[model samples]
Target: MKHILNTLIIGSLIAATASSCTAKFEDINSEPYRPGDLSADDYALGSAMNNLAGCVVSSDVNTAQFTDCLMGGPLGGYFADSNANWKATISFFNATDDWTRVFLKSDKVLPVLFSNLSVVEVVSQNTSNPVPLAIAQIIKVAAMHRVADTYGPIPYSKIGADGSITTPYDSEEMVYNKFFEELNSAIAVLNEHPNDRLTATADYIYQGDIQKWIRFANSLKLRLAMRIVNAAPDKAREMAEAAVDPQFGGVIEQNADNAAWTYFSGSVNNPLFVAKEYNHEGSKTGGDTHVAADIIAYMNGYDDPRREKYFVKSEWTGIDYVGMRRSAKVPELKTIGRKYSGINLSPNSPLYWMNAAEVSFLRAEAEAVYGFNMGGEAKTFYENGIRLSFEQWQADGVDEYLAKETKKSISYVDPNEGINSYDKELTNITVKWDESATPEQKQERIIIQKWIANWLLGNEAWADYRRTGYPHLLPATEEGNKSGGVVDSNRGARRMPYPVAEYNDNAENIEYAVNTYLGGRDDMSRDLWWAKKK
Candidate 1:
């Protein structure tokens, strides 16, 4: 009994000693330093900028490659599948999910951009420095607008309101109007600090140049304003005027001022260049990317100097620029892959969100459509746009190319049998600014050239084509539209379907949006408010 009692006393003493040591060292479990204490500019601004750039320019499958390269590239008629691979993407069949990925928060870029912007906005709440906050807001609008354009109604104003996980959506129209308001607020903030440094070190597009940000903002405004011309002409004219109004700021007027983000050197090369032609076996075999017949024929017909830069000479057809038709499902695609022209594969190339050439074309369209004071006639702006595009790409013979009016787009002739051939003479459309052409003809001329200048910026090009129905994109008849009767594959996809997660997580809001904004259904057949046919 004495021995047992002694053991109990020893155990008790050890327990007490252990408790003391644990209490003494407990503080070590906490963080050495809190990251939350950092200022928005110190962290949030940089995070927002990088995240935004990544979402728009990254080569990851879920981001830029899927949304821009795979979908936008082919749909915009800038490229075609040389190997006839990725049929689901090329044919618009089984493509709904890829389209919806642009808006979904499931590891996609849009949600990351929004989250970073929110952080920036919160951090700037107590500061007199509005530059960081303004830049965040501007990028918010720039990035979200693409999302809004992808699917008709999206979570915009109510994204994180009321601390709710399931956010309600704003109508496409409401989202567009909100974009204008956001731009106005951001511009005002920027104007207040004319000399203040932007987050240049963090910014990939402008390197914190406040003036360039202002220019990009105005250029973005102009682009958005033009999008609403058909659906909301009065509002379009008003907003467009506001964009170019001297009081706000000037638009991007030179190639140097274009909103572009270059790839990081070495390991972080351009994703498109890597994914399309250099990443894996597909890339090693030259991948499926080739110049679209639609675009190549037009360029070849006009003797466009950009052709050499845009594509490699065909090895099979023995032609300098052989292209494949978009959405062509032929056995020949499997055999004659090397015969087609290859796309530009520079790993260091910059991804353009908007360019001076595109902005000039927007101004031309504005002057032609609304008679806005663009400081030049529509014809002058039109010609300037062409020259800027040539200079932007470092192409020669701008004068000679512009001088020819009679050279029409040649019909695409497939060298392989069993492949469908189109000989529509795309060049029947001329480059010469015909002063006496009908208003419709003039609009076509402007939009087609604008499309040419647009080149690789697939989302913008696709959006513009949806809005104007210009350049007369050929209809794709291959199946895979899951919308049943909702999407007319012939009219082309109007918008991507709302993500399935919305139906699961935010069912009530999704239902209401479909009923009110989407005519009782969520399908690609339904046009966004701005893209509706007039």
Candidate 2:
């Protein structure tokens, strides 16, 4: 993508950090260790922004494959593994090194590219200017939230401070509190300079549009606030209200206002596209990217119009759309791969960081859950989410689709399975909203729709599933988790354990974090503070 140049800037910074200092020298860290004037420029800020956006939408890198794609995509029931190696982890819930990849890229690269000291220096240099600093803070919050959400706790406020090389982990509460504070600071600054911007030349997402940045900040706040609904309802309500509060800035309401990162064709293409189209090693076939059976069953049952754009027909079975079972083995997956639908792997696909459909669904959940004001009734917002999702994909027949109230998720039947392949009927969840449904039923309906609307965004779906336990997903295969009887196969994975490297150098900190926030164990079965079901 054209944004490849932006990533190269951050890549060079990572290389510089790796080769700058020798392992045996502590006294040789003075001149060459310092960033030049170019590192503190607005272009650097642009590079940092690009880097954060890229990670948030990561699907290609090893770190992202484990954290975002493997943990998220499969757990959320969006995709299934093609290789037996990956399938073992996905189906049996085994702990692997793949889960550690996200932190490696994030810790070793991003924070350094936009160092905290450099950002503070830039802010001090531009005392009369708040746009640059505000933008930097928003990017920081965007990047850090993914890390904090994946693991229970992280080094947030003091990551790059002097003498904080091996920073201690803050509790999840502290990290979220800091996120709110930073977002508040950014929103206040953005409000002060409503339309002003320092630079947009390097911005690949919104082109230096400060107004869009403000909207994105508020939208993010809404997301973070909703994440804590089970653990901190009062705080969630307070922040959710503020997100829609006209006194500050309003939440994202239009598809045109969505925050999506664009990509250039060729070598700088979207990683997800490359993985799907090219002969990635883990995939079953050279060009097979199978969708999950649950999604296909639900979409096909609802007569979804977006399926045409979301998936391609199977060349083997000659079926219009067929999704693979989540626990299928390599041989079955290989044959089924020939008949299963592949995702839209066009190099031109945009990576949506946040979208209006998500905002609408969030508002719907807020209204349905607590009767919070969201411009109108929860049903209206819910329907709008469906409409906007269709519009975003440029699909038609939404009005006709929305009008049907009898459509429900159909029972799944593996096309390649014979008499017994663990085919189960899904929850009879329907697309249309029922006015007289119970609160719990309404909540389930809302979340199920949200899950359907949010295609390719597996992390958010996984979080919501863990939080709400809606869109009732299939259980792990009979293989079960390889946790030595630690992880409950019925419960599924709650949060990823910290990287093994964190334990090597910062064992005390990791121990403290696990004991403080994770109930004295650094295991995958333990839920994060916010993920505990009410």
- Per-model TM values vs. the true structure: 0.86, 0.87
Where does candidate 1 clash, by residue pair? 93-480, 200-207, 200-208, 408-427, 409-427
Among all windows of 10 consecutive residues in model 2, the one with the lowest summed lDDT is 20-29
Model 2, 434-473: lDDT tens digits are 8888878888888888888888887788889888987877
Model 1 lDDT, full chain set: 0.69
Top lDDT model: 1
Clashes of each: 5, 3
Off by over 4 Å in 2: 1-42, 85-91, 104-128, 161-165, 278-289, 316-318, 332-334, 418-420
Task: Single out the weakest 10-residue window by summed lDDT for candidate 1.
Answer: 20-29
